[model samples]
Target: MKRIVIALALVLCAAQPTLADKVAAPIPIGIAVAQTSNVALFGQEQVNGAKLAEERLNAAGGVNGTKIALVFQDTAGDEAGAVNAFQNLLNRDKVVAIIGPTLSQQAFAANPIADRAKTPVVGPSNTAKGIPEIGEFVGRISAPMTQVAPNSLKQAMKIKPDLKRVAVLYAQNDAFSSSETTTFQDAIKELGLETVTVQKFQTTDTDFTTQVTAVLGANADLVVISGLAADSGNLVKQLRQLGYKGLIVGGNGLNSPNMFPVCGALCNDVLVAQAYSPGAVDKNPVNKDFAAAFEAAYKKGPAQFSAQAYAAVQVVVEALAKIEKETGKKIADFELADLRAALNKSLRTGTYLTPMGEISMAPSGEVQQKDFYVSKIVMNPDGKTGSFVLVSE
Candidate 1:
């Protein structure tokens, strides 16, 4: 009888749950972007923005007083890298949601992984067409190039009414640049500008002599170049150096402070289409507050990529709060699968006043943002510093 009692007590004690096991812990949010490699120019800014979001949220008591944690996985500027990063975040870190894979091409390859696993993903800068159509779990804060890309062309034509012979150039290897070029072409047609020459180049190529010579040969009055910051800035510098500049208009890719160092004084007089503008502080208190906070931390106005990444994290945090409110459970206490599903659904139901102005997630994982602006690049005499001066709505 003594042996039997001792054995029974041991079994019951072994089955009892411990305090550590029962108590929920801080929520985990995953950030997957290129923290290294060529894309890191943009990805580093994204990381900074996400960290700022974490700091501000935690300081203000982070989602009903429960702390939130960020898990970073560098995507390293390639498709395979993005896939590996997402896998680690989902499987190893057990993160509730993920916020990256920078380039649109990378998103096309890696977003499906998260969608299949039922994890929510918010793309900060994937602006190619059909990005939101990837799956129920994928969405982006970046507006499609179709919506905002044309405004700058129109503004350019307005600035130069004689800008009739238009030449369009884009990096063929990039999905976003390809899509953006198509939009630019369509807009050029709509605006009744004559298409003089359409040029193509690879993103990795540094020399634009052939393309620049072609544009000059065509005697184009206005030039449109669609490529990432490094390549696009080089294209602009080469175009200027080759004495082929009439009026240069850039795709969304050139709308970054990173382009300043790449193009130097040559980046001046370049018109860029923007999804978010610091001038928006008047109508958007969120933008105003974010700009102030970001300037305080980084000593400069936040770029669109950084602001969009900040908004992505903001969406996840706010959506998680909604899940907790409706389900009456702490974030860490919710089952991972159920939490992911619930957060995806909750994020689509509300409009978030983000740094990009009033924005919301569509049921199909598309972003709906209200305002867009066009700006001109104004570089200081130092040839290395600049700002985007707002020119049009």
Candidate 2:
């Protein structure tokens, strides 16, 4: 009877641990970027950066020695796609936090899902005006149009001090391009430059004959474009082919190297405002390490999209560590809901030295980044490749 009682006690003790004592091993973080569609150019870069961050962070003992798994769901460059991706990541994958949905329009549609669920989301490249205003649970690593867009215009004026009339063109269907054009227009007005013409096009449009004709008819000395890779790149190619000798200013959307092939040699001399630059390696140690790692992995310099995505992943991982430290509890042990809430609170409370430079999240979940750059594309003789030469910082 004594032996029987002892065996029964042992069996009872060995039973599955209670929910309070169970640990959530291998933390899951969702990456919901557009891995398909026309936006894949930017999305692919973001995925590269996020994956690099995951590998580096995990190797260094991720989140208090527990490994983190990145859950990927393609948002596919549309509002519906983003919403579906968000739903899957939140409900099925049960990720602690999410990073992405590439464009600002997607963010407007999808972010509310996470916000409503009280799950944290960090936008890698959603830079429209009202992204942060989405919800307390939402934030972005990318600088808004209000801050980053005007720099390119300012740089253009510096290059051509007597520049007078400006033509502005954008993708009417894109929330980002629309918001960015507003900034460009405002800056043009502030600089006392006349609005020669404003032309609109859809993201799916290939031929810009109508728009290019309007720009030339106006005889605008400068042309500013606010659109995505394919459309913007095509616009550049057409503008140059039809003979617009004046300077061209590309919005943040053109910051990717993927724009190279689209415009060929025509991409040269196009001015763009940057939030990240490989040249920053000389000044920032973090950027130096990131650049080295990036070059080794991809055999090319990292672009703004990659750098921003890496920073987003870094932000979430660091925030998780902060939560573990402050709460005196392992993130694995907290309920998923509790961990997410804690992470959102902790993520906003600190400054991070990212490749983009030292950045912090505001109480409202807006990222405060210190540095911005303006660069000009200097295409190689190959015409299919180019580098964004640092024009100013």
Task: Give the Å shift of residue 357 in candidate 1.
Answer: 0.9
Least accurate 10 contiguous residues by lDDT in model 1: 15-24
Look at candidate 2 and give me any clashing residue pairs.
none
Report the C-alpha lDDT of model 1 over 1-393, residue by residue, as the tens digit. Answer: 999999999888773422222212578889999999988988988998999999988888887788889899999999999999999998778788899979988999999999988889989888888788999899888888998899899888789887789999999998788999999999999989889999999999899999999999999999999998889999999999999759999998788777899989999989998998987777788888888999999998898878988888888888888888888888777777778888889989888888888889888888888878889999999989988998876
Query: TM-scores for all candidates?
Result: 0.86, 0.87
**CA lDDT scores, all candidates in order:** 0.88, 0.90
Q: What does candidate 1 score in Cα RMSD to the true structure?
A: 7.6
Candidate 2 residue-wise lDDT, 153-207, digit = tens: 8899999999998999999997778888999999889889999899999999999
Instruction: Estimate candidate 1's alpha-carbon lDDT, on a 0 to 1 scale.
Output: 0.88
Error of 2 at 276 (Å): 1.9
What TM-score would you give candidate 1 relative to the actual structure?
Answer: 0.86
